[model samples]
Target: MISQAITPRELDRRREQLVDLQRYLADQEREYAELRRRVQGFIDRYVATLGPLYMELDALESQLYCAMRYLHEALARNGLDTRGPDSPKATAMPQLLVLPAGAPLPPEPEGGLIQVGPPPLKTLYRRAAKRLHPDLAPDDAERGRRERKMAEVNEAYATSDRARLESLLLAAGESMVKVRGGDADAVMEWLRSTERAVQGRLRVVQAHIALLTNHQMHALGESVERAEKKGLDPLGIMANRLRAQITERRQELYIGQRLQPESSLTEAFLRQREQRLGGGLSAARAP
Candidate 1:
């Protein structure tokens, strides 16, 4: 019974990760478009005479190509389709899914798409804690106990357990508000907070892994060496490298926040002027 209760919560967590991955891809696409617009300005003003501008343009194009590839790979990893004929280029591109012409895109799923809903174990814990906490206690020892129970309330809330949130506010303490109605702002706030907390925990775990200098890492390295000695295939190494590249691109998409352009074409033309004259025009013009 305990395992059955726990399974769906784990699935919900997995779904949240995929949603973040999608957001990351979208941001990458926006940034790529901005870069292209900027480079197009240089292309217009210099008309291919600006060597440095050409190089910058090439780099931006390459970045877009790589970003698209990363988006495609991420979609495949999540068992989502990368190829939607309507947005052929966007298939592998991050930040926008291509829908067939005249067809409206599907709305982002509510809460998320991975699990049934919030975990049931969380409410059970919150109820138990609320009954014991010092703040809601019938006496002094009970109050001290309640203070400690506050930590449990926080943990449950952190997991986006709606039932637990309601239970914490309702059990004994009095000033309770029912959370029956779903608020968009409240959901978004919780989602962002959860994302930050998870990322923080992941960083800590990664640091610990890095610090395991001579023990686990060295042992793993020695095992890999032994395997290579027994004849590891060159193709496997190449495949691993490709996987690494795709992962790095996904990470970039996550960290790099993208802003939509207000005046894309104008910005492009301005960039071209700036490129022709090293960011500003000279007062002395040669005829």
Candidate 2:
């Protein structure tokens, strides 16, 4: 079985194929991250705009049901079959009552009991990478498309937005967390580490951009008033601007502030975010 080895040309070709596959894999990873970012942004935007409507709708529906029940009870006492045989009440009656139009609805459960699926580490990584794998691309134009997709995924993963990450994990059917022997500390540590590794650098870049914008706005006090009307804190913006200015002189100042014994960057960001969003967002500490 000691046959001669393959020719140099064949060996070279094999190497090239391997290289191509490696490049493709890298591209896939980047694409995955970008997809995650887009998903997170969409979720954020949706929650921002329609979360209230959902809350309102829930409340209204609850009130409507309760009122209808009271009304039904009253009618039953008075022996009125207002509900037709086709009505849902005909099968199993619920108490019915009525209230004025546009009246505030009774409170309902804020949200349903959510059933979280397993975490997805592998599936997301693969799907994301596949979407932008250069090997899968047939031509230069297609390769370029992959590159762009890869860039977005990279950026999104860099932000470490876990809500979107979880969504991606669900879609991909992978778990970031292991279930065999649950070590709470280890799991939390990994989560924290992953978040910081992904989100920290991008957040710093975003902060820089925000600082520049704030500085410009401070120069025009009129914009400050507009921000106030939008429920923004002028003083806090001013403070951030001041911090930015100081950080310019000492680049580590921001890092130091975030690394304080009491606060992590994620926690600080959430606190600031809550102040901006009327304290409606979930709270989590960053690494």
Q: RMSDs, each prediction? A: 26.3, 34.6
Name the top lDDT candidate.
Answer: 1
Q: Which stretches of candidate 2 lie over 4 Å from their true place?
A: 1-11, 76-79, 82-287
> Which one wins on TM-score?
2
List, residue by residue over 1-287, the lDDT tens digit for candidate 2. 11134333443454455446445544544554454444444444444444554444444434434443444344444444333111222112111121112223222222111112233444444556665567788999988977776665566567855455445434444433321113333333433443343344434444443443344322344455577789997656544564554344243233333343333343343334335435443332222
lDDT of each: 0.44, 0.42
Q: Residue 37 CA error for candidate 1 (Å)?
A: 4.6
> Which ten residues in a row are the worst by lDDT in model 1?
85-94
1-287 per-residue lDDT for model 1 (tens digits): 12344454554565578468546645544554454444344333333233343344444435644444554344445454333111212112112212212223334334333223333555545555546556567888767767866776777767866565666655645332222323333444445555565455445434433443233323444554577788974335644565565565444433322312232332333234335335441222123
Residue 90 of model 2 has an lDDT of 16
Q: What lDDT does candidate 2 reach at residue 44?
A: 49
Residue 266's lDDT within candidate 1 is: 25
- What TM-score does model 1 achieve against the real structure? 0.21
Task: Tell me the number of clashing residue pairs for each predicted model.
Answer: 11, 20
